[model samples]
Target: MNNWKPRVSMGIPVYNGENFLREVLDSLLAQTFEDFELIISDNASSDRTEEICRSYAAKDKRIRYHRQEINRGPAWNFNRVFELAQGEYFKWVAHDDIYAPEFLAKCVEVLDRDDSVVLCYAKTKFIDSEGKILKEYDYQIATDSPQPAERYRSLVLVNHRKHAAVEIFGLIRSDALKKTPLLGYYARGDSVLLVRLSLLGRFYEIPEYLFFNRDHSQRSVKEKQVQIARGRTIVAKFLGMGPLPPTEWFDPSRKGKIDFPEWRLFYEYFISVKSFPLAVKEQISCYLYLGYWLFKNWMKLVRDLLIAAEQLVRASYKAQKIIEISLEKRF
Candidate 1:
């Protein structure tokens, strides 16, 4: 790549993504909008990921591939691509997802005409591992609202998994993105980031379904225990707290503590509103909404705790059984 700058920067953060990396890259390369730079941050994949990326980089001048010396977690890898981006608009592409050739062109057109729009994404269709269209996903979050409070309420109160958080992969204004913490190293961090961006400006959604999000078993959102562990690791890294016990890590009863991921999300939302410029009425309204949000999600919090407890009990029972079998064999 020369000293040329592009209007948009597309970053794909992959880890051991050799399976669909080529297909994703091919889709990106076929984009009608060619004046964009594609940055691939490989998280030290031991698979064919490095080979595939390097081969593409050699052929395409716009493609820049960087391999980490060691594997950083998904959060770091995702943020690294944006940090190295050199474009007015930036987007994160998942290696397993497919984008239509016109995805970039349409998103760029929207962002160009609307200065008030800080982020733009198209409707999403969920695809299976075989690339078969599963269903069209309807993420009914109110990010499109002109009112910041409405946007914030939708982002903060709505269940992120239900909404799919597809907007996290949308084309974002680099300036607006820089103003907020890109992504925190916690579960549902993408949702919190979206909330922050909604506070900054409105999000525009293309009516067409140009983005295809692949839903598979390996997706991070599907792994509840893994998410808990990742959130704990992040908390420990930042707070200088030694590794947290499993009980403390996933317990919603311990609100206001670093271990509670949901509480941390609300705290982040509160900080975003407090730090930003808002009218007194808006501020009061947001705080009131926050209370409403807590009240509304109280049962959901209990359900989460029950699920976590069930998982823990199952794990402990499995461990005890394994030990018993081992003892019986020894005897």
Candidate 2:
């Protein structure tokens, strides 16, 4: 109830995050900007998450809490909270991550000054489950030397989801955010949103450290390999199946050997474009990724075709043998 202008709505969606719920709430309460509304949506967590949310809501007049009847997963819960937000600027908080005291204050200042920046994010510190600081993600996409358009092209063409900062805490223009449908895709939903937003306007970069992203074993990336693998399928669906380009290839970042299929699928996604020039460039980049994605299975597509042909030949031979045997028996 402080006498300040409300500028941002922060959505915090939780599911069984009891261990770190109190700390996260306390950090939000300590923010320097007292004009924000904290919207907490509980995804029917069986843990003490509901209790913690209710306790905070009782104390803070600006805090709003709602509990869903069924667990709808993180994407749906995130969209639900965002759909209910009332502020001009929107920021999403994860169940386990922490924010600096001045995080919202600084982000709001930038957004207030500039009307062109649709999204703004600060440097982040990686932390463990116990809130122990591990390292900083300062160098990921912040320092790319090229212009925003070129840098964005490189990152998006390569499908740099892991290298791109997680979208959990960035403050976004609510109007711009509302333009894109959230939670429709399978994997890399945040990346897709960021790319879509970038398509509209430039992104504001805050070099200061303001947020913390937690790395835990229970993250969906680890528990669901099949779903993660299917991310390639999603990329393929978007890329489309077309012919005529042999030059486009993907040059995956060699620093990490993770999610190789996604890298290739990223290429396929790009190559599906109808433009002749973009189609060529995307094809070459896709090839670079293909080297990594189809490395051992380099000949998978060809191998499958060859195997099918052999099977057809063998079937025909078997039929001929059966015919000869029947003829001898009749004679």
| Predicted candidate 2 versus true structure: per-residue lDDT over 1-331, tens digit per residue | 6564357898998888897888888988999988889999998999899988998999998889999998766667888889888898998888788888998888888888877677777888899887788887754542132233433454454434347446436888999888666543234556556655654445776778788888777654422554333323333334442211111111112212222333333443343232122345544653453355455444534433343345467668989999999999999
CA displacement after TM-score superposition, residue 171 of candidate 2 (Å): 0.7
lDDT of each: 0.81, 0.64
Name model 1 segments beyond 4 Å from true.
Answer: 221-258, 299-331
- Which segments of model 2 are wrong by more than 4 Å? 1-5, 142-148, 158-164, 221-331
Instruction: Estimate the TM-score of every prediction.
Output: 0.81, 0.67
What lDDT score is found at residue 225 in candidate 1?
57
Model 2 Cα displacement at 273 (Å)? Answer: 9.6
Candidate number of the best TM-score: 1
Top-lDDT candidate index: 1
